[model samples]
Target: MSDHLVKVSDLQIGFKNEEGELIPAVRGLSFTLGREKLGIVGESGSGKSLTGRALLGVLPPNAVVSASHLSFENTDLLTAPSAELRKLRGLKMGMILQDPKYSLNPIMKVGNQIIEAIQVSNKISKAKAKKAVFDILEAVKIRDVKRVYKQYPHEVSGGMAQRIMIAMMLVRKPDLLIADEPTSALDVTVQESVLDILDNLVDERNMGLIFISHDLNLVSRFCDRVLVMYSGQVVEELVASKLHDAKHPYTRGLINCMPTLNGSLEPLPVLKRDPSWLGAAQIGSGK
Candidate 1:
């Protein structure tokens, strides 16, 4: 087996405007993932979520996706049949979307939803699936598993809902997990707890994690490597710990723009945009 779990090269995603012109959203993005957490950090609309969605074959119907090479393990995602893609989703690859309110089914009990996910990925009986669901709920630090099992999406707090989402995705024990701002809605303590669960999964299961967020400090502490994206392109890729040593101006600007508690009282530095970055050499070449 190859060392990489996912391979993407020259991936481009766009949508046709009413005028019938292609407006690119993700341009020539290339990267590879192994059994490690890779963080993609950028502002909103920088193509972080789009890249994750594209990998899962979950992009909108109007999306135009083209790539030189896009593969998951040995399967070519770009040409894979819908059935094949469906089978891979939630079984071999799972995504934890940003908002649980929109992601979860409002009418179904949370436990049933997770049980369905487990059974859909595996041909397990409801009894066994329920056991697995409860186990995963506990794994994600949900204190009252039995109570949460019968509750609807709206019943749980934001933190608990996030954990339930994690449980739903992890019950199948996928090889790859894409977490888009998974902890954005949680408190700091809950966020740390969630991160710990992800850390354990990566270590125990050798799962490849794609953590997408705008929290640079959190990413630096939690991920092994970081991809700094700007305007739908990766401007810099470096070790998470060395983010302060970034060479790209855009990356430096992002770091500088972060508010500091004890630093200068003056206004934060504004990021100056450069058109040349769009055509620059791809930093995330996965070399």
Candidate 2:
């Protein structure tokens, strides 16, 4: 197996507009992931989520996706057949969507959903799969597995529901996990707990994690390295601990926009955009 779990080069995602002209949403985005946490930070429309979705071939029917190189381990994702992708999706590469409310099935029991996830690639018996679900739910910190198993998505709290979603993905023990703002809706305290659980699991499983979020502060603190994107381009990549020392003006502006605890109480500085930034040279490999 390759040390690089995911390698994306010159990736682009485009959608057809009303006039049938293709407009690129993610342009020339490239990064490599190993068995560590990599954060993608940018504003809502900056193409962060779309990049993650493209990796799993979850883009909408009309989406125009192309890449020079988009490979996961030894598999070439762009050229892989649907059957091959299906075999790898949950078993080798799992994705945790931003919200469990929309992601989880409203009609089914949470435990059943997990069992279904486990059986996506495996031919295990229901009894074995159910036990796996229970064990996985417990691993994600759910105390009453049997109780939560029978409950619907509406029955569980937001935090617990998110944990259940994590458990569903972890049940397969994927090598690469793409989490898209898993804790955005939760309160601050619950958010930290969720992140802690995610981090611990990624480390314990020796899996690569791609954490996508709009919160720069959270990304800097949680990820091993950070990729700062703007207008569909990754302007900078830097070690998370040295985020404050970033070279790109866009990265610096994002860091500056974050409110400081000890600094003066004056109005925060606005981020001034530069059109040339879209065409600027990118910096640093995540390594």
Least well predicted 10-residue stretch by lDDT in candidate 2: 278-287
The superposed Cα distance between candidate 2 and the true structure at residue 273, in angstroms, equals 1.3
> Lowest lDDT 10-mer window, candidate 1?
278-287
What TM-score does candidate 2 get on C-alpha atoms?
0.93
**Best prediction by lDDT:** 1
Q: Per-prediction RMSD in angstroms? A: 1.1, 1.7
Q: Residues 13-125, candidate 2: write the lDDT tens digits.
A: 99999999999999888899998999999888899999999988899999999888999999999888999998888589899998889899999999899888988878899
Cα error, candidate 1, residue 150 (Å): 0.7
**lDDT by residue (tens digit), candidate 1, 1-287:** 88899999999999999999999999999999999999999989999999999999999999999999999999999888899999999589999999999999999999999988888868888898888888999999999999999999999998899899988998889999999999999999999999999999999999999999999989999999999888789989989998888899888888899888898988879999888877878875656
For candidate 1, the per-residue lDDT at 276 reads 85
> What does the lDDT come to for candidate 1?
0.92
